[model samples]
Target: MKSSRKGLEICCGITATFLIVVALVFTTLWFTTFKPKEPEITAYPVGLEDINVFSIFFVRNITLNMTITINNHRNVGSFEFKNATAYVNYRGGVVAEVPIGQNLVPARGKLNTTTSADLMVGKIITNPVFFDDVAAGSLNLTATAALHGKVRLFEFVKIRATALSTCDISFSIASRNVQSTCKSKIKL
Candidate 1:
């Protein structure tokens, strides 16, 4: 009976040590190989697709074209974006909303997406600041994009992430030129 008890204790000790070693190995691997990295996002104004400012009393329309770029920096993970949306605003008012749909960005890859916004020209022109900006020969707009998705590591592990990007675009009406500045962030 004494010998049997000693053997049982030895087996428990070995099993405990084995479990500790396996946990340490997995922790090290997680830190070194499976951690998710933030992605870079940028927006560029492609052109003004259409603009109608013919009359002061008549309703007008404006269509703006733009492109968004997503750069994934991770070497071992890919991103899957689902049900994203991009919004265009003018002087604190939302002018348009564009759907980005779904996309998959491979590891260390870049994705360029394009969108078009149909501005609510009737609403925009009614604002007091609209005439002032038109007189100045430029229009200032803001573009915001929200992406909700998951970062997949290997084939089975997925981490939920949300990415947001905002850009300030200045359009020169006379020359049809565009200048923009953008900022981006990601949360996991």
Candidate 2:
């Protein structure tokens, strides 16, 4: 009876190992066969194409206007973005970082959203040189947005994509004319 029990334990161990190996192989094949597309993201200052609010500085208050456009390029499932944040930079100095809650962008369609950052002119304009530059007008701004999201395949398989976008904006306070260009990338 002791020998029989030892044999039964060995058999169970071997069976478990075989099942684990099979499961690993199946998972490998599944990932190699299935591919999920990354979502497309674009960001820019709102209404820059025509006439729009780029940045307004009045007294000690400053308001920056921007928009982020997200497109779920895949046909399968909706892309959900969490912990989205936007940063505005002036000459490599980060002025503000705005928190944009969670968003679920529909597949094949697009989500056009707007976010604004209110900054204090006194705090950001610390040095006299920077203040002089702003007083002269023609401020160049660089804005960046990062989002963490995931796309699911076959209901259970989830693919994570980190979307990043950078925008270069040129706004003339004196001229009231603004122009910007942005490029987006996704890391899977």
Candidate 3:
């Protein structure tokens, strides 16, 4: 009976040691290979598709095209984004909202999606700041985009994360030139 008890104790010890080793291995792997990371997002203005302004008081119509790029820097994870919308704001008011469809970005990959914003004449003319910016020869606008999705790691571990991007656009009405600066953030 004593020998049997010793054997049982030895088995338990071995099992505990094995579990500790396995846990250590997994912890190391997680820190080195499977950790979550934020994606880099950037926005570029493709061009002004159409711009029509009647004097400094009225904007007949305006259309702006833009490209959004999502870069996944992780070596072991992929991002699956759901349907989202991008908004264009003048001063503090939203002028355009564009839908960005679902997208999948593979590991260590980049995705470029294109969207267009059509500014309504009524929305622009109602804002008194629009006239001031137009009279100054430039239109200052802000473009915002949010991507909500899951990051799949090792085909099993999925983490919910949201990537938000905002870009400040300065458009020259006379030269048709666009200058933009963008910033991005991620929430996990």
| Highest lDDT against the true fold, candidate | 3
lDDT of 1 by residue, 110-154 (tens): 999887777788777777898899899988989888789988888
The regions of model 2 sitting more than 4 angstroms off are 1-40, 46-58, 74-77, 127-137
TM-score of each: 0.76, 0.63, 0.80
Which 10-residue window of candidate 1 scores lowest in summed lDDT?
48-57
Candidate 2 structure quality by residue, lDDT tens digits, 1-188: 99999999999999999999999987886566444454566655654334322333334655666667777655365667797778878766787776677887765678888787765555456644665666787667777877788865656767787777777878776666777777777677
Error of 2 at 58 (Å): 5.8
Model 2 pairs whose backbones collide: none
**Judged by lDDT against the true structure, how good is candidate 2?**
0.68
Show where candidate 3 strays beyond 4 Å: 24-33, 49-59, 135-137
Ranking by TM-score: 3, 1, 2
How many residue pairs clash in model 3? Answer: 0
The deviation in Å at residue 177 for candidate 2 is 2.4
Report the lDDT of model 2 for residue 166: 79
lDDT at residue 182 of model 2 (Cα atoms): 77
- Give the per-residue lDDT of model 3 (tens digit) for 64-167: 67788888876478889899988888888998887888999888889898887786657767888877877999888898888899888878989998878888
